[model samples]
Target chain A: MILENNFDLKRMASQVRRDIVRMVYECQSGHPGGSLGCTDYLVALYFKIMKHDPSFNMDGIGEDLFFLSNGHISPVFYSVLAHSGYYDKSELKTFRKLNSRLQGHPTTHEHLPGIRIASGSLGQGMSVAIGAALAKKMNKDQSLVFSLHGDGELQEGQNWEAAMFAPFNKVDNLISTIDVNGQQIDGPTDKVLGLLDLHEKFSAFGWDVMHADGNDMDGIVAALEEAKTRTGKGKPVMILMKTEMGKGVDYMEGSHKWHGTAPNEQQLVQALNQLEETYGDY
Target chain B: MKKYTYTESKDTRSGFGAGLLEAGRKNKEVVALCADLVGSLKMADFIKEFPDRFIQVGIAEANMICMAAGLTIGGKIPFTGTFANFSTGRVYDQIRQSVAYSNKNVKICASHAGLTLGEDGATHQILEDIGLMKMLPGMTVINPCDYNQTKAATIAIAEFEGPVYLRFGRPVVPVFTSPDQKFEIGKAWMVNEGADVSIFATGHMVWQAILAGEKLAEEGIDAEIINIHTIKPLDEKAVLKSAKKTGCVVTCEEHNRYGGLGESIAQLLSTNTPTPMEFVAVNDTFGESGTPEQLMKKYGLDSSNIVDAVKKVMKRK
Candidate 1:
């Protein structure tokens, strides 16, 4: 596992947020709200919590693997993957471009490093993560499979199906996290269709459910470390991470308007200015 | 005319069961997933032997499909077993995005395909599956003709990489193909050779094509019979050669005429051979509850139908 002392995670989180906004601004199309919201959690995992290799082998045997279920948040995922040294960080500029490896959504067909399955469709990542976890068990590999999903995406029935499966089959090596920003394309999750009590739903599905303040880097790190301890018992672990939509940027924070919208030239400058260039811009 | 006969009949789903068991024995990476249709899909033997490898997703076809796609990441060749209706139409998006577009090495083995899934009626029977599977890019769609062929195809796809849709059916059908025959994907098997008309059939229709060839020989109208099993990467060379010699073609399958083997053959002929053609398939209608025999006759998917189509296409020629 990589040590948190090697680099300042707060600085890295700021840089990741900058990458997210710039990616969406450059493309004029891409998801930014959820990507910004989930930045700190990803920074904590990739930089401190997870044991992974940046050389980027798809098989990912004997190494911790992560899958982004809500693939529209490609900006944050691509940035985190690049910053973690999976590929040349300059490739972040090509987000959503024709023939670029950085597709609008994460895909394996482009042969992108660090991505095993393509997941733009909501509620699919949990099942894939469970499958990988099952494979890890079959191979006797001790590493765990991690996946992130949008809480609004849990409204998809497939998540519940997979939710029931992981715990029943004793898939204890998997850790599934949900970005509970409570915002989707249509509106607030509660207004569109309330996901009443995620903790209860997951607990009823026989998972070891826990909550985290997703925007807080330390809290995410502590919660993830705690989740790791909960593994290998008998049930899968779920981190119900509560984050604000567009957490970093002042105007975009805690609103659904920026859920999928790109910032204008002036707004881009404003958003980027809010995030410190701790690691410099790509 | 070459003679073909069978002393016994067996369901194609049992062929899948036997084939899956053999695949599991041959490769440790071969895993099976079923969505509450273990007995129907004939995956019981596989589940019994390799209980750890088999995943019972319990009525969630979408989850089963995606999980199979995921398993492929760790070098596991996943075979998802369920009825054809739930396999193709029910979870098409998941299959398209996660399996097809993602290009995962997943074997979507489907049983009880088409109108032959009798007594269960239209809701259970999926006649449009062949079309649905074939349209996906990089998907290999194989509808094996009989028990032996289905078993052979099931075993063969485990060796071949990439996504495949193996369509088979319920009801006992004659096992004409050899059990030891090499099942090659995207290749046509020449059942019989003739000069007057070409009869290309798929799925459960190959036996009927052979029977039609025999009756056509008795009528002095020589008919070429070919089993076109793999539909997506069609045997273009074989199709063109036969269509050129016969100057007419008759495509048979237990599927809708709109997107079945007939349409594929029509596209092939229009592009390469431009041969006159007739279709012995369902014409845009859903199936009703009945015996497999009754459905075959009513839907014009029997040997008599093939013979009649051949005669009609010959007049066009």
Candidate 2:
């Protein structure tokens, strides 16, 4: 609710992209590909779409819930959360450091605002999203639950379990999106474990599936709007976002190698040049 | 000898169902979720009274655990229902991350615990649940003795914030705990007091310990019976005081000997005040399909086991 009218989601995206690099570089380890890929969409969700308070309450109380199912990309999730006023942006430098609130995987025990559950183990956030949606239904609150997952994480049997559950149980208050970067740690998702056709799979599971260019802020915003319309229909909505491994930065773009390996001093400088300090470095 | 009047024996899960309905009425935030085990977990009352508040997740315990964790974020105290096997070992990672590590105030209500689950066999019975839940850093594990205590504990956890694991049994057991006794989380309740040996028991074993103490008294053995309901953040003061005075101890539970209440008591005594102790529990084995009484005896978890363990430990004293 503290979101300002002057808030430019694109500016937020740029700053987030910068922090994504800074954190990965500082930690010398993190998933930059998916983090870079989801920057614009995460920006749209936090800066534009969702309503939350930055005073950092774990129990969001009357506020919308955002869950990160694929927790390895803590760099991007951390950047967006820090940017949105959950914590001092300067705290971003401490990502993955000992005793830091921002661990390798995001944890609510740290009492960070906007994050409800810890979901480093993928395929869980969807169910967690449904549960939160169910809570909203119980409380009679109209707030929606949002969750993001990696495309590779779909291979987890629990994802299909949740996919089957949300639709069948009428968990319609949730909007779940997948980070379809098509790349994971081992190799291309097809090589590691072929996802085959994600759309048909989700469609068969009864989710209202929508595809979007995740890097384009406008497309993400529009798709989210379309997703919102699909809500209250007694069926959960899934957005399959097509994105480059490294979307904005040219050197790291389109490769799974950047998925977890962080940029060194020179590489970080090169990456940061592509991302302007719109909101300043976190 | 006076003959006791025939009343009724009910599964503790039914008590949970009754308690859920009452808790929903008392607290506006208490919402219940079940992964297709509503009838089995005895959550029908809550589901019937508050349909909007009850969620039927359809045989997905992993999803159920994570979702319950998420619900806590919006200031909702979610009580997730499933069998003890599904609730603990099946979804340990989900609970570890979402509920335990994140410290979400979700109540993991596990029904049909231990060999008492019966007939369904080892696949259903969960002897390791107490150990599994207690190992978590910030978890409060409670194994209520009977129907009334199970119901009371269900209502009790709603008010006490933080993560809780409420374990209950499936079989129809004697409901003898005080109907009006308040459910306190970590304080052990002194059921009866004697001096020869201290009998610290939990879950269905509480009633068994009482029976064993009564039998031991007739044989000129003085026994102190204590109900250690809350397993984690254990009532160390009560345990040590009784063990130190009696100079001997016997721990009983329908759980594994490795990480169950026996191990906890052993640790307490070995570290602070060492005392002779014997364990009356399953000895590194799984249970088979049988009646509740049969499994208890086969697994050596009956009151006779407690009685024998007490005598053995007292010999060391």
Quote the positional error of residue B158 for candidate 2 in Å.
2.0
Worst 10 residues of 2 chain B by lDDT: B1-10
Q: Write the per-residue lDDT of candidate 2 for residues B128-235, one digit (tens) a residue.
A: 999999999999999988888888998999998999999998888888876787998999998888889999999899888888887898899988888999999899
Pairs with backbone N, CA or C atoms under 3 Å apart (clashes), candidate 2: none
**Model 2 TM-score, 2 decimals:** 0.95
lDDT of 1 by residue, B92-161 (tens): 9999889999999999999989999999999998889999999999999999999999999999999999
The TM-scores, one per candidate, come to 0.99, 0.95
Model 1 misses residue A143 by how many Å?
0.5
- lDDT tens readout by residue for model 2, A148-182: 99999998888888898888877888899998989
The local distance difference test score of model 2 is: 0.85
User: Tens digits of per-residue lDDT for model 1 on A94-174?
Assistant: 999998999999999899887888889787888888888888888889998889999899989999989989999999999
Q: Could you tell me the TM-score of candidate 1?
A: 0.99
